[model samples]
Target: MTVVTKPKAQPRAFISLRSSVDFVVTSTTSEIIDRALGYLRAGFPVHFRGPAGTGKTTLALHIAAQLDRPVMLMVGDEQLTSSDLVGEQNGYRYRRVVDRYIHSVVKYEEDAVQNWVDNRLTTACREGFTLVYDEFTRSRPEANNVLLAALEERVLVLPTSNGANAYVKVHPDFRAIFTSNPQEYAGVHDAPDALSDRLVTMDLDYYDRPTEISITASNSGLDLAEVERVVDIVREFRDSGEYDQAPTLRACIMIARVSALQGIRPSLGDKRFVQICLDVLESKTAYTSKNRDRRTAQRKMLVQMIDHHMAHPLDAERV
Candidate 1:
């Protein structure tokens, strides 16, 4: 009997494989980090569910950074094709092989495989890159059927000369992370139960006070006192049924950013600050009429809220 040995496989070319340890995970967003870490450890895909502007995409990016894998992101669209997720056979080229008009010339031509294949999902699977399918459910589910097998069986069926082909087995380190709005929201789909079952689902809502304040102050460059005051007003307004739609952390951050950009302090006395808050509330409430009147009346009430804040800056009481 004779024994034979095969050569070791070479590593695939990755975009970049370096992990960054610095990421801010406020209490409001800590669950995102925990869920991502859990999936990374358990070898499962994670589905982050939230309303728009809830930091789903940011959370996914933070996870990719922590895992030290290069991130590949694809925003789902209605016209997305399987070839868009995988690669396609670009057309071939032709050359004149010979010139026979005078019967005195000979020439040679050659055909070869295209040197490169577009590697969206393929590269991620092969090189263990972190893939973030942002707002994946926005696209029709039919467009993503091919992913079912690739995600479950860890096999990518690529097109080749012989019809369809299979590439290197999915690397053990590969991970899939998805973010999407809830199905009830506009432009989102109820993911097939089969696919949903395979993923670890985490429903994310608005951020809590401490976390919201921390994020606003740190990211928006607002003073801590001002951040707290803004968070209080937004949280109270949402809880008090003053608006049909709840204020998202995104809205708060936006308000803070706008205030900073305008060189305005977080003082409630600034009419412009009140107007900014009103604008955010209006945009968030446009989808529902349940509290339309209440939202409309909030403008009048904001002046009082600002006056109270100014008069009793040290009240230390929640609105």
Candidate 2:
């Protein structure tokens, strides 16, 4: 994470979608996108399930944007509740009236009522905004129970709400995209069977080699050839299954982007580049001071692995 002459301002590591020209589209991603879009068009809520760093959230956002609708983004949390997704009555609204027509008698009336405010889910269902619920499994399953009817019956049931607002008919244009990391279990809950049945789930994994190279190059502003080196080393390290946490394409972008900013090449001959690789990838291990020996051993292996990959060029093939 260290750089020689640190960037004074935030680095533009990524060139975001400015137009169709800047959009990162490849045959691999296009197929996935078209498939997800098709399910969505068929009136099914699409779920992107995967392990961490698989681009689930990014792909969800891209698909949502393609729908040409205003998007509502909500991140699931351990403390999230149904009221957090839908609306809830918090404060009270009060009104008072005094009778002036009766000269002989005075009358006064007062009433207090609870106020209901729409939350992200309620608003999206009511206004037809596309909802991208990221990492939804992190929220308690009970909290997400509200989505069952919203996704299935095309209505949001407000059991606690009273009056004509008891239920909201979901807008025709309303759509939902959910992303979750199944490998995360500490705070994440299992997807409810009912909820899972309602969604068109798409399990995802790392993209092919060319897609990774294109994404890294596009995001880091590094040329494809240099980006390929960083990707190859990291991908090989991941496949080795030696690290506690596997390095994803994100790791590749970090090395390439930072090296480019510092005018360093992604070559083992450059000490700075090698350090950057270790700094980016080695810490992904589970080693701590309790096992400094293991940490050092992994560090040496990472360096040797980098040298090996840099020395032997991998053929341009799907990995």
- In terms of TM-score, the best-performing candidate is 2
Q: Give the TM-scores of the predictions, in the order they appear.
A: 0.80, 0.88
Candidate 1 lDDT by residue in tens digits, 48-70: 89876677877877777777778
Which candidate number has the best lDDT? Answer: 2
Looking at model 1, report the run of 10 residues with the lowest lDDT sum. 1-10
Q: Model 2: runs farther than 4 Å from truth?
A: 1-23, 102-107, 312-319
After superposition, the stretches of candidate 1 with alpha carbons farther than 4 Å from their true spots are 1-23, 93-116, 159-168, 287-295, 307-311, 314-319
Output the lDDT of residue 152, model 1. 87
Q: Would you give me the overall lDDT of model 1?
A: 0.71
Worst 10 residues of 2 by lDDT: 10-19
Please give, for residues 105-130, the per-residue lDDT of candidate 2 as tens digits: 76677777776778889989998888
